[model samples]
Target chain A: MTPAVAFQKTSRHFGAVRAVDAVDLEIKPGEFFAMLGPSGSGKTTCLRLIAGFEQPTSGSISIFGERAEGVPPYRRNVNTVFQDYALFPHLNVLDNVAYGLMVKGVGKDERHRAAEDALKLVQLPGYGGRKPSQLSGGQRQRVALARALVNKPKVLLLDEPLGALDLKLRESMQEELKQLQKALGITFVFVTHDQGEALSMADRVAVFNDGRIMQVGAPEEIYQRPASRFVADFVGSSNVLPPDFVQRYAGQHRWGSLRPEQIRVRSDTSGDGVAARVVSRHYLGAATKLSLDANGLRLHATLPSGTAVPEDGAHVMLTFNRDQLHLMEEQA
Target chain B: MRSDRSQSAPTGLKIAAAAGLAFLHLPILLIFVYAFTTEEKSYQWPPPGFTTQWFAVTWGRADVWQALGLSVQVAAISTGIALVLGTLCAAAVSQTRFFGREAISLLVILPIALPGIITGIALRSAFSLAEIPFSFWTIVLGHATFCVVVVYNNAVARFRRTSGSLIEASMDLGADGFQTFRHVILPNIGTALLAGGMLAFALSFDEVIVTTFTAGQQQTLPIWMLEELVRPRQRPVTNVVAMVVVLATLLPILAAYYLTREGDQIAGAGK
Candidate 1:
C-alpha cells in the first residue's frame, strides 16, 4: 500500500539554523503518525512541509505519492488545526466553519448544512452563531477542528492542537481527537513536543532531535527498545552503568535503559539484580517511584504498592530482567 | 487591565477631560447656536430672536449652490485618488522589505504629520515650478497628497495586523494569487479601506489653506465663505454655510468612527 506521505532526504533551514535535517520516512495510510520531539526538533517544520505551508530546501516531499515541492499550502490536499486554534476572530462559529466550503463557491444553504454536520461530529451542535471570543477555550478548539474537517481532506495535520487546553480538557480532547481520526479513517500527522502526548495518542511515534528522526516505531517499541542514548534519555528516564560484556549476560558493556515502571522491589539483598541502595522514595498513588544510587550511578525504578516498600537510604538489590534491557552503543 | 484603568479614572482627570472636550467643541456649538439667530453679524450675547429665513435665503442663492457643489466634487475626486494611491503605497511599503523602507514610510506619512501650511506652500511652489496653471484637478491633487496619507495609515496598519497565516491559509487551500488577495485579504481589510475613505473625504471637505494655494480663479465653499466674511454683501449666508460645513464634516467623522471601531481588532500586530 502506498504511504500517505513520504520524505526523501528533506532538509530545511531558517537562516543558519537547521530547522529540519535531511531525513527520510514514509507515513503509512490511515496511520496516526506523530513526530515526537522537544521544542525545535523540526517536528512542526515537517508538518508544515506536508501541509504545503513550507517547502523543503533541498530534498523531496511527497503527499499521497505525488511530488509536492511547488504546491502551495492552499492547493495542498491537507488541512491543519493550528496550535493557537487560529480561528477567524471576526467571524462567528458558523461562518468560521463554513469558510473553506464558502471559499470553494459552495452554495450558502449546503455549506451551512455541511458545516453543521462537521460541528456535530466534533460533538458541538448549534454553537454556530457564537463568536470565537465569546466561546470557552474548548469550544473554540472544536470550532477550529470543525473548520479543518469541513474540507474533508485525506490527511489532517495537527500542530499541537491540544497544547493550549488545560490539563483535564487536554486529556479529553486527546482521546476525542484519536477517536475522530479512527472514525474518519483519514491519515493523520500530528506534531508535538510532549512525549506523553505522542506516546498516548499515536500509533507510530517518530523520535527526533537536532533536526533528524533518530528512531520511529510503535510507542511500546520506542519505550522498550530505544536505539540510542539520546532516545533512552528522551523517551523516559534512564540509568547508565558501564557494561560487563564478558562476565554478565553476553555483550552487556553497552548502555542499557530501564523504564521507571519496569522494576521490582525486593528485600535487603544484592543478587539476581544490579546491586543498589535506595536513595530516595516518592510516594505516588498505586505506586512509589524510587531513585537508587548504585555505585556512583543514579537509576529510576517504580514499584507497585505492596509490602515490598523499601526505606529511604536503605541498601537494597535492584534486578531488571535480562531480556527487558537492550544494549545501546554509547557514542564517543 | 488597561480597560479597567481607563474605567477607573479619578474625578479630577474625568472633569479635566470633559473640560477639554468642551474647549474643543463649544465654539462649534456657538456657531450652530447662532445659525438661527435674527442678529445677522453682530454678537448678541443671547439671541434677540430666532428665524429660519437665513436658511431659506442660503438655500436659494446660486453662488452658495455652486460652491457647495464644487466642494462635494473636490472631496469626492480627492478621496478616490487617495484610496487608490494610498492603498497601493501602503501595500507596497508594508509587504516588501527594501533598501529605503524607512524613507518610503516617512514619505507616505509626512503629509499628514507636517503642518498644513507647509503642505500648502510646498504644493504651491511645486505647481509654479511645473508651470501648471491651478484648476479643480490641481486642487484635488493637492488635497490628495495629504488625504492619501490618511488612507495609507489606516490600510497599512490593517495589513500589518492581518496574520500572514490567513494569506498562507488561503494559498494552501488552492487559491491563486489574485483570488487569495481578492477573497481573503480584501475582506480582512475592507473596513480599514472604508474608514480611510470616509476620513479622507472629511479632511478634503473643509480644507481651506491647501485650496487657497491651488484653487485658481475658482470658488469652492470655504473660499466663498472667506470672501463673504471679508466683503459682507449677503453675509448671514456665511453663518448658514458654517452650519452646513459643521454638519457635513461631522457626519463623515461619525461614519469614520463607526467604520474604525473594530480596526483595533483587525489590526492586531505581533506585539
Candidate 2:
C-alpha cells in the first residue's frame, strides 16, 4: 500500500527565510504520527504542505500515492483542524460541521445527519444549534474536530488543536484525540510544540529543528536514543556531558548523554560515583527536581518526592548505569 | 452603573444638554410649526391662527409630485449602483495586498473627503467634456461618486473586522472560491452593506449642490424646493415639502443607525 503522505525534497521558502527546508518524510497509513518541535521549527509548515495550503517551492508532495502539485486545499482528500479552531463564526454548530458536505452538494438532511453523527463521535451531541461563540474553548475545539472529521478524509491534519485549551482540558482532549484516532483508523498527522503532548499521544514522532527533521522514530526510540544532540536535549531533560568529559570517561570520540531521572543521587558521600552538591530543589507534588553541581558541571535530576535526598547545598554522590548512557556523533 | 458621576454633575450641564438639543432641532420644529401657519406670505414669530388648508394645497401641486417621484427614482438607482461598485472596491482593498494599495484606498475616499462643490465641478466638467447629455442618469452618476464612498467606508470596516480565517476554513472544507464567498464572506458583510445602502439613499435623496450641476433641466425635489424658496410663492407650501423631505431622509438615517448599532455583536464572534 502507498504511504499516506510523502514529501520528496519538499522545501517552501518565504522570501529569504526557508520555512520548510528540503524535507523527505513518509507517514504510514492509519498511523498516529506527530511532528514535534519548538516554534519556528517548520513543523506547522510541513503539515500545511500535506494539506495543500502551502505549495512546495521546489520539490513535490504526494498524498495517497498521487502528486498533489498545484492541487488546492478544497480538492485534496485531506482536512485540517486549525490551531485556532477556525470555526465559522456565522454558522451554527451543525452548519459548521456540515459545511464540507454542503459544499460538495450533499442534500441538507443527509449532511445534517452526518454532522450530528460526527458531533456524537466527538461527544458533542445536541450542540447543533448553538453558535461557535456560545461554546466554550474546549467545546469549540471539539466542534473544529467534528467539522474536519465529518468529511472522513483519508488523512487528518491537526495543527496544535489543543494549543488554546487549559492544561486539564488539554490533557483530557489529548486522551480523547488518541482514542478517536484509534477508532477512526485514519492517518492522523498531529503537529505540536509541546513535547509532552507529542510523546504521550503519538505512536511515532518526527523531531524537527531549524526547518529540518532531526530524527524520526517511535516515542521510546526518540526518548531513549536520539540521533543528534538537539534531539536528545529537546525531547526531554538530559545532562549532555561536555566533549572533554566524554573523552575522559566514555572514550576520545563518543559524545554521551543521560536522562535526568537515570542519574542516581545519594548522600553517603563515599560511593564509586561522581561527588556533587545539591544547589537547589523544586518540590513538585509527586516528584522533586534537584539541580546538582557535579565537579563544577551543572546537572539536573528528578527523584520521587518521598525519597530521602540530601538537603539543599549539601554534598552528595550521583551515579548512573553505563547502559543508560546514550552516545551520538559529534556535530560539526 | 456610573450614578455617582451623573449625580455629581452640576445643574448647568443638564441645562446645557437641553439647550444643545433645542439648538439642533429648533429650526426643524419651526419648519413644522409654519407648515400649519395660516399666513402664507411673510414670517411670523407665533402664528395668529393654525390651519390644515396648506397641507391640502401642497398635496394638489403637480410639480411637487413630479420632483418627488424623480428624487425617489434617482436615489434608488444611485444606491443600487453604489452597492455593487462600493462592495467590489471594498473587497479588493480589504482582502488583497499589492503595491499602491494605500494609494488606491485614499483615492477611493477622496471624493467624499473633498468639498462637495469640488466634486460637483469635477463631474460637471467631465460630463461636458465627454459630451454626455445631462439627464436623470447624469444626476445618478453624480450622486454615485459620493454614495460609493459611503458604502465603501462601512463595507471596508466590516471586511477588516471579519476574520480572514473564516474564508480559509470555508475553502479548506471543500468550498470553491465562489462558494466560500457566498457562504462566508457575503453573510459576514451583508448587514454592513444594507446599512451603507440606506445611508447612501438618504444622502442621494436630498442632494442639491451636485444635483444643481448635473441635473441640467431636470428637477429633483431639493432643486424644486430651491426654486420655490427663490420665487417665494406660497412659502407655507415649501415648508410642507421640507417636512416631507425631513421625514423621508430621517427615516433611512434612523434605520441605518439602528442597523449598525447592533452590528458589533456579530454571531459566533471569536473570543
Candidate 3:
C-alpha cells in the first residue's frame, strides 16, 4: 500500500529562517510515528505542512499518493490536535466535536450522535454540555483529541498534544493515544520535543535538527546506533568515546559510542578493559549508575542492582567487549 | 474591622467626593428642576411651583418631533455603517500581519484622538472641495467618523484577547472561511460588537460639534436644542426636550456598560 503521507524535498522558509529544509520522508498507514526534536528544530513546521496550514516554499507533499498542492486546510483529509488544545470557546464540547461533520453538511442529529460517541471514545462521555473553560487542562486535552478524532480522517496530526499535562497525566495520555491509534487503525504523526515521549510511545521515531532529519528508525535502532553525535546526545544519554580512542580502536573513519549500561563496573582491579576509579554513584532503585574517571577520561557505568557497585573514590576496572561499541560514519 | 475601614475615610475626602458628584450632576439636576417649574419666561427659583404642563407643551412642538426623528435616523444609520467597517478593520488589524499594519492601526484610531473641532473643520473642507452638499448623509458621514473609532476600540480589544488557535482549529476541523467565521469567530466577538454598536449610537445621538459643520439647513435634536437655548422661547419646554435626549442616550450607554462587563469572560479567553 502507498504511504499515508510523503514529503518530496519539502522546504519551508520564513524570510531568512529556514523552518524546514529539504526534507524527504514517508509515513506508513496505521503506524504511530513521532517527530522528535528540540524547539526551533522544524518538527512543528513539518507537522503544519502536513496539516495544510502551511505550504512548502519549494518541492511538494502528497497525501496517500495524491498531490496536496494548493489545497486549503479544510479540504484536506487530515485533522490536527493543536498544542494548546484550541477548543472553540463559543461551542459546547459536543458542538466542538461535531464541528467537522457540521461543516460537511451532515444532519444535526446524526452528527450529534457521532460526536457523542467520539466524546465517549476519549473518556469524556458526560462532558457534552460543559464549556471548554469549565474543564481542567487534561480534560480540555481530551476534548481536543475527541474533536479531531470525530472527523475520522485518514490521518491524525498532533503537535505536542500532551506538553501541557502534568507528568502523571502525560504518561497516561500517551498510553491512551497509543491504544487509540491501534484501535482506530489510523495513521498518527505526532510531533514532540520530549525524547522520552517519542521513545516510549512511538513505533518509529524521526530525529530532526536544524530543519533537517538527522535519522529515522525504530526506537531501539535509533537509540543503540545513533546516526550522528547530535542524535546520540539527544535521543538518550550516551557516553561518547574520545576521538583519539575511536581512531586507535575503531579506525579513523568512524566514531564510537557506548551505552551507559553496556560498561561493566567491577570493584576489583582485575579486568581486561581500562582501569578507573568511581567518582560518584547514584542509587536508582533497580540499578546503580556510577560515574568513573578512567585514567583522566570520564565514563558512565550503569550496574544492575544484583551486581556489586564501587563506592565513591574506590579503585575499579571498567570492562566492555569491543563488539559493544557502536560506530557511525564520520559526516563530511 | 469594616466599621473602622469605613471610618478611615477622612472628612476632607468625603467632602471632595461629594463635591465632585455635585459638580458633574448639578446642571442635570437643574435641567430636571426647571422642566417642572411653572415659570415659563423668567428665571425665578423660590417663587417657582412644579407642574406637569411643560412636558405636554414640548410634546406638541412639531419642530422638536422632526429634530428628534432626524437625530434618531442619523444615529441609527451611522451606527450601522460603523458596525460593518469597524468590525472589518478590527479583524484585519488583529488577525493578520503585513507591511504598515501599525500605521493602519494608528489611522483607525486617529479620528477619535484628534479634537472634535479639528475633525469637524477637516471634514467640512473635504466635503466642499469634493463638491458634496451638506445634507442628512453628510451629517451621518460626520458622525460615523467618530462612531467607527468607538466600535473599533471595543472590537480590536476583544479580537486581540480571542485566541488565534480557535480559528486554526476551525479550519482544521473542516470549516471553510465563512463557516469558521460564522461558527467560531462571530460568537466570540458577538457581545463586543453589540456593546460597540450601542455606544456608537449613543455618541452619534448626542454629537453636536461635528453635526454643526455638516448639517446645512437641517436641525438635529442637539442643533434644535442649541437654537431653542439661543432664543427665549418657552424655556421650560426646551428643558423637557433636553430631558428626553438625556434618557435616550443614557439608556444605551448604561446598557453598553453592562453588556461589556461580562464580555471579558469569553469562553476560552486567554486559554
Candidate 4:
C-alpha cells in the first residue's frame, strides 16, 4: 500500500528564515512516525505542511497517495491534535467531538453515537458532557485525541501532544497514546521536541535539524547508528571519543554509535582494552550508570545492579567488541 | 499615584469621596424632587406643596407619547443599521489589511472623539450639500455615524481576544471558511456583538445635538426634551422623560458588563 504521508523535497520559507528547507520523507500507514527535534528545528512546520495548515512554498505533500496541493486544511482528510488542544471554549466535549460530523452535515443521532464511541476509545466515556476547562491537562489531551480520531482520517497529526503534561503524566500518556495508535490502526505523525518522547513512543523517527532530516529509520537503527555527530549528540546520550579515533580508523570504526550497556567492564588485571576510571556512579533502581574518564576520553557505562562496581579511584578494564563501537563521518 | 502619598487612603480622602458620590447624584435627586413640587409654578428650591398629579398628567401627554415612540423608532433603526454596518466593518477591518488599516481604525474612532456639535454640524452640512431631504432617515444616519464607533469598539476588542487557533482548529476538523466563521468565530463574538448593539442603542436613544441638526420636521425624544426645556409647559414631564432615558441607557451597559464577566480564559497556541 502507498504510504500514509509523503513530503517531496518540500521547502517553506518565512521571509529570511527557512522554516522547512528542502525535505523528503515518508510515513508508512499504521506507523507511529515521529518528527523529533529541538525548538526552531522546523519539525512542527513540517507537520503543519503535511496537515495542510500551510502549503509548501516549493515541492509537494501527498496523503494516502493523492497530491494535497492547495487543499485547505478543512478539505483535507487528516486531522490534527494541536499543542494546546484548542478545544472550543464555548462548547462541551461532546459538541467539540461532534463538531466535525456536524460540519459534514451528519445527523444528530449518528454524530452523538460516533462521538460516544470515540470518547470511549480514549477512555473518557462520560467526559463528553464536561467542558474542556473542567478537565485536567491529560484529560484535555485525550479529548483532543478523540476529537481528531472521530474524523477517521488516513493520518492523525499530533504536534507536541504531551508537551504540556507533567513528566509523570507525559510518560504514562506516551504508552497510552502508543497503545491507542496500535488499537486504532491509524497513521500517526507525531511532532515533538523531546527526544525521549520520540524514542519511547514512535515506531520510526525522522530526526530533524535546522530544517533538514539528519537521519530517518527505526528507533534502534537511528539510535545505534547515528549518521553524524549531530544525531549521536541528539539521541541517546553518547560520549565522543577523541577526533583521532574517528579520523584514523574511519572505515573500521564504522560502528558509529554505542549504547552504554554494550561496553564490557573487563578487569584491569589482564586487559589490552583502553583503560578508564570511574568518575561518578548513579544507582538507578535496576542498573547503575557510571560516568567514566577513559584515559582522555569521556565514556558512559551502564552496569546491571549486581555487577561489581569500581570505587572512584579503582583501576578497571573496559572491553567492547567492534560492533559496540560506531564510526561517524564528520559532516560539513 | 505619587510616592509621597500614604498607601492607605487618609480620612480626608474618604470624606471627599463620600461627598463626590452625593454630588454626582444631586441633580438626579433634584429632578424627582421638583417633579412633585407645587413650586413648579416658578423655579424655586422649596415648593409650597407636593402633588403626584403631574405624574398622571405626564403619563397622559400626547407629545411625550409621540416623542417616546419616535425615540424608540430612531433608536431601533439606528441600532439595526449600526449592527450590520459596524459588524461588517469590524469583520472587514479585523480580517484584512490593505493600505490604510491604521487610517481606517482612526476614521472609525473619529466620530466619537470629536465633540457631538461638530459631528452634528458635519452631518447637517453633508446632507445639505448632497441635497438629501432631512427626515427620520437623516437622523438615523447621523446617529449611526457615532453609533458605528460604539459597536465597532466592542466588536473589534472582543475579536482580538478570541483565539485564531480555534478558527484553525475548526478548519482542520473539516469546517470550511464560512462554517468556521459561523460555528467558531460567530459564537465567540456573539456576546461582544450583543454588547455593542446595546451600547449603540443607548447612544442613539438620547443623542440630542445630532438629532437636533438632522431632524428637520420630525421630533425624537431628545429633540422634544430640548423643545420642552425651551417652551416650559410641562417641566415635570421632562424629568419623567429623563428618568426613562436613564433606565433605557443604563440597563444595557450593566447587562454587557455582566455578560462579559465570564469566559475570560486564554487558551490555544497561536492566538
Clashing pairs in 2: none
Candidate 2 docking class: medium
Q: For candidate 1, lDDT tens digit of each residue in B129-231? A: 9999999999999889888988888899888887767666666555668877787778877889888888788788878888898889888888888888876
**Model 3 per-residue lDDT at B102:** 97
Residue A291 Cα positional deviation in candidate 3, in Å, after optimal superposition: 4.2
lDDT of 3 by residue, B24-101 (tens): 999898888889888887757853698998888888989999999999999999999999999999999999999999
Mind sharing the TM-score for model 2?
0.92
TM-score of chain B of each: 0.88, 0.92, 0.92, 0.88
The per-residue C-alpha lDDT of model 2 at residue B91 equals 89
Candidate 1, residues A44-134, lDDT tens digits: the string is 8999999887788989999888999988777788988888777766778898888888778899999999999999999899999888889
Give candidate 3's root-mean-square deviation (CA, Å): 3.4
Cα error, candidate 4, residue B103 (Å): 6.9
Q: Give the DockQ of candidate 4.
A: 0.72
CA-lDDT, candidates in order: 0.83, 0.89, 0.89, 0.83
Error of 2 at B64 (Å): 2.9
Off by over 4 Å in 3: A267-272, A275-283, A291-298, A306-316, B1-8, B263-271
What 10-residue stretch in candidate 3 chain B is worst by lDDT? B262-271
- Tens-place lDDT per residue, model 2, B1-271, is 7466645667899899999999999989999999999887776879978998988999999998999999999999999999999999988999888889999999988887777798889999999999999999999999999889888888888988887777778888999999988999889888888888888888888888899988878899989988887675688899999998888678766777777786452211110
Instruction: Tell how far residue B149 is off in model 3, in angstroms.
Output: 1.7
